[model samples]
Target: MQAQIENTAGKRLWIKLSAVAVVVALAVGGYMSMSNTHAAPDVSFTNLKGEQVSLKSMRGKVVMVNFWATSCTTCVAEMPQMVQTYNAYKDKGLDYVAVAMSYDQPNYVVNFVQTRSLPFQVTLDTQSKLADAFGDVRLTPTTFVIDKQGNIIKRYVGEPKFAELHALLDKALAT
Candidate 1:
């Protein structure tokens, strides 16, 4: 009956693995739904070009506000993908603003922006007020996708899946 015992053991292992897969799927779904549906707080910042931009004025467009620090390794690693995502969506009414965390030095932010030749607007939150308004963001590469209705729809920490981001932007811009 050795074959019978081996078959039962394999079935038990398969059942355990299926259970774990279900649990992991549920956890990921929960995390995706838990981003608080808050109205994006009113904020403004001058871009690297020194022109002031207010969130209130961007109400009719899909906005992606990304908080990053120059020294955050993940943030640095994700910059090129972020730039590509913005470029792909900007013409479709996506308004992207990359904000530097206050603790990041101004000269460093400037140099990074210049060296990278980032295509979207890049602002510096020198006072940290913007971070406070955006839920006291203390993490690097925090991203929020705000729909045209001004509701914060998606919040991503670390790096986002660019393809998923494109799909979200596509859905947002269609309305």
Candidate 2:
């Protein structure tokens, strides 16, 4: 009876350890999938004013290249925070540009911009070239924070954590 009880207890411990291992594996995998860091691809899109703005041209400044769509409520919802983030950091060598996804209609983008009185550069990815350059951004509200050296320091798929973003910006600005 004693031996049987010990074996049962060992089996329970093994099962618990296996469950914990699986949870740890999944946590690491999820984090690895989300953290995509790379060099900011060189590309250009037509700004609202019809001038071409290139990511390569903004190499010396911290740039936030955001891919968004008018149809995405989350994208629209985050614009105010984005604007505030830009306004707060622009003077410290931060450059922000919002790129309307290729699937977004130009009229809707224009209307959104006008209604919001967006202060930063708003551009259109009409040809989808810019999207392709930025890892084929098919998701609205995807944002990339590029350092002054043109490396993408962070990529947020949805609304970013404003506090953490501000911290990253602080570090990026100091560089």
Candidate 3:
């Protein structure tokens, strides 16, 4: 009878410990999900026109920062869409900046911008500081969508689907 009681007590303890473990696991999971999105680093960019633009100043606006290189075909192909996206949302409080990689020739970028008549801000990362600030971005056409609150909402490593991107922009702008 004593052995039976001891066994019952042990089983109850085991169940209680298991419940505590589960609760802890759930709490950790929730915390991780909540902390997934991080704030964008504060950085300044010099546009082609030699105007200084700081990310901190862009607060309260949905900003799109694209890291691109002139030699990248994909970057070239998606630029038109980027222009369209900027044109579509610029008046709705969206700010866009295209950062040419440090390796890209300034003349090439200037010529491309002039030929295309790109309306958004075009900046050159000549010292690569901007790239390092943006998570050491090495791939061409890497894009980051920052929410109005200055948190990085999404990152696209390659060409993003325009439709989905538009949907995300619409949702973000609505708020």
User: Against the true structure, candidate 1 has what lDDT?
Assistant: 0.93
Estimate TM-scores for all models: 0.79, 0.78, 0.86
RMSD of each: 8.0, 5.0, 2.7
Query: Which residue pairs of candidate 1 clash?
Result: none
Residue lDDT tens for model 2, 1-175: 9999999999999999999999999999999877756788877777999887788999889999899999999999999999999999999999999999888999999999999999899998888888888888888889999999899989899999999999999999998
Residue 5 local lDDT, model 3 = 100
The TM-score measured for candidate 3 stands at 0.86
Worst 10-residue lDDT window for candidate 3 reads: 32-41
Off by over 4 Å in 1: 1-36
Question: What is the C-alpha local distance difference test score of each model?
Answer: 0.93, 0.91, 0.95
Residue 59 lDDT, candidate 2, scale 0-100? 88
* lDDT by residue for model 1 (36-91), tens: 46799998889999899899999999999999999999999999999888888889
Write down the TM-score for model 2.
0.78
Q: In candidate 2, which residue pairs clash?
A: none
lDDT of 3 by residue, 84-163 (tens): 99999999989999999999999999999999999999999999998999999999899999999999989999999999
What's the lDDT for residue 49 in model 1?
98
